[model samples]
Target: MSPNNDKETPILPWDHFSNWVHAICVVTFDLELGQAMEMIYPADRELTERERTNICYLAFPDSNSGLMGNVQFHFRIRQCPQSMNAHTRPAIHTYNSNCPTSIQIEDGYLYGYVYFRQVKDRTLRRGYFQKSVVLLSQLPLVSLFTAVLELVAPEYFETGEASLEAACHHLDQWPPPTPATTLNLPLLGTLIQVRIPSRQDKPGASSLTPPSPTHTMSGPPSVLIPTPHETEAFRVLAPVLPHLNLLWELVITAEPLVVMALSPTTAANTVQTLVSLIAPLRFSGDYRPFFTIHDSEFREYTTRTSAPPNVILGVTNPFFAKTLQHWPHIIRIGDNNTGSPSTQKHKLKKASALKTVEQKPGVYTKYRPHLQADKGLVKRLLKGVQTGRPVEVQSALLRRHLLELTQSFMIPLERYVASLMPLQKNISPYKAIPSLRPFNPDEFLGTLEQHGPHLTSGIRGDWEGLYRRFFRSINFSAWFNARYQEVSDKLAELHLQAVCDADLGGWVCSRSEVEVVDMVLRLRSKLPRAASLPPSHPARDKLTQHLHTLFMALPEDLRAVLHAS
Candidate 1:
């Protein structure tokens, strides 16, 4: 037989025409018509009867797609069994402004379900068409991988005996189209032209073949950083950022319709999956990264001579406030504080000049304002009798650092007080005793016990001596003002003013202070039991346990109280 032809025939694109289309089948369960309406047509404001009835399906389109290709697969709306109203036949109706869109039944869980279908048809004019489920694991990756899959792989998902397992069986046998081929004419030509020296050649020639591509990792090597930005996946996901709210809307609408008990964990997991899908797209490190934003304008400020005078940029963003609330994480001056005479104040005045002012990429300022808040709280309560305003207190990690700074401050104050005590001991009383009005420690004690839970609780056991020394040595007002400076100045001032008023026997205390004191006292009483109680407590062992639970239960507005004091 003649030598078999080794040359391969090049594949023509026209010979193999393949079209892929995705179809979505939405299966809503236990959802009534009214419940579905609310889910599909949620609005910031309540809609009237006519408006509610005419509710439109507001769906967002896929952001990343080829110009000519179909991006979003399909949209479907359908009804399913109502677990809540299985006994009673239900009627869906539009409710009045006060009433929300809901199922007519007494109880149930509603599901706004979605089914995905990806269809691939090859143009095989002569052959019979065949379809079969194909195992995804068996297929070589044709599309980019997702982090979500890495986090919770298909194997980890518990597709049960009848549900997801059966659905997955269908996924495993999908008849896969042949792999598309790509050619590089230039590369082929280069390969052919490359001459190899034979082993028979004299001198240093050796017989060696180039390494095959199969031996090495196929893609170009890259350094993978944990930074969410700078990834190709992030770029693809970014466009869907605005539509992130859609998931939340879907849940809220489905909530009233379904009577089944959807565990909070289940709901939260679903929401998180949705968040993971959307967050990757909006992973812009330069701007807002989370739901809340830090908003503050940076102004140029004077600096020390050792350090070049710098433009002070004041940040008023709530995020910064939250960061400061963290205890020991002192914000410090950026190391890149070099300022040239050419790039000075007048340059900042110019439009172009503003861009030239350099900021140290990672430097931060010290905790000036934060320190003041800690010292001032006591003084303010004592003097002004003014309550602390609504403030977010950083706890756990934040508390750890803050407690450190407070302890450091108390040490110096205590030393000074000790020195003063020795001086008093040295000085003898005069033979003729000067009549003086008696001072009552009770007045101070009552104020502290009632208003300052941090002081009271922290003073328990041996810590009282440490606390007393600091109080004895310093002018609490001056210390408060100095530590906080302009940073935590407002809170410090409030606390100091309160203290001054209380000391002078003035009726300056406000109802707000009384309320704050009551809150602290109650919280203190509850804290120990919550900490000590076993997980199996029949009734919650402490009120503090309810704080987080209550927070999760309330509307977002009321939930804000957790962050605010």
Candidate 2:
């Protein structure tokens, strides 16, 4: 049953994806105010001081690629702005420039999906044309939103307000965030057919495969996460490829990891990809794709002696290299100056063996990768790049390889977890509830000798070493707790069932006379029936009949006292 609390779960009036897009604001860099929202289309109502401040600040990212390029980032509003009447917030309106320079969130959920761009231009006084197209919504659909922005933002930059108005209206026609359904969204002279993942779906549960033949769909799906399109996936994974094994361990163990990239787009996307790597087993940890110095907990996150445990932060600014130097695990990606006469996308310069004073651009880890890298997979990826294969095909290759690798380890864990369930008959209400037997690493590893990673994957090495270390991590603790609680709750439910189904009459009769009296009184305490009720409740009647049976079997003196009561 859904909770009755309105703040926790608002009853939204509008149901489509269009309705969730509450505002389409354009943020620009002003010499005076660091960032300001200049235009808000269909200015439905004036934004209060708090709304303007937060919207403008978050709309434009704190840092950039340093080079001219379009970048993307997401902003999370802890609460909605006060003026946003949740029930009426249907279409997104741009932000206004009414002298206010800050923004604040309200009491509900909201997010800002921004497409920030910077370019060297002679017309602008700052010697750069800096602006961001922001879509304010009640959800974060990064993969889909990023794709849409890639198409809309450049045109909006060229056509200005007119383009934004058309795009916003077109987006207004988009359906709600429904998973397992195909959608054809029309915008800017193109009809796009794709199945988008639901923001509500757990990671790894969102299927990328074509629907089974028995399941019909309108058409094939398009680029999705866990495996993004070749360019984005390559950009995200390439910088960390040499340390892929180490990175995987970090994510698997749910360690604190910070990704430093030149672009917030890359930083945030990489964070999202990291969480998705070990899909099916959700990463039960906190993560921020783009962490801003202006965020409320900026001090807590940056100035802290250690990065928050199991928290992943992606930051773009070089300043973080020094600010977050104390962080234990970091992946700093190489920046690609895309516009610098470089036609090739994925080229790399030699990585510094240590963190750079400015922006270190490689995996920063002393942790050894227990497993050997699959030279075959690396060869395939490099061969495709050398031969100039389609980015989608190459991205798919990496995606498939990673997916298989994840399954190789996860299957055994699933089997082990299932094996832990106690037989229903073993559950007893009269005694201590049974527990899932402790996980003995040695015993479990013994099973791995037969059905382990080597049988399922081409990549092979110290699998035992990997699992042993994993048992010590907080990731295992969380995984165990979640599964343990579930099994414990099931055991409780089974106990109740066993109590209800037991031969209460025979069991009670076998006990001493004193225990029978106590047991009857205890059973009666559970039946909260009013004496005023007309003599029958199914629950009360059963207990009454059992009492009568006990009375007939009881000593005459005890029966007389029970009958009198």
Query: Which candidate ranks first by lDDT, i.e. highest?
Result: 2
Off by over 4 Å in 2: 1-12, 15-25, 37-55, 64-70, 75-111, 118-129, 136-140, 150-175, 185-192, 196-231, 337-360, 428-435, 438-447, 485-565
Which candidate number would show the highest TM-score if scored against the true structure?
2
Write candidate 1's Cα lDDT for 487-557 as tens digits.
33333333322322222112213324444434434444444434444666532333444334334444575
How many residue pairs clash in each candidate at the backbone level?
Answer: 58, 13
Q: What TM-score does each of the candidates earn?
A: 0.16, 0.68
Encode model 2's per-residue lDDT on 127-160: one tens digit a residue: 9898998877654456666677777889999887
What is the lDDT of every predicted structure here?
0.23, 0.63
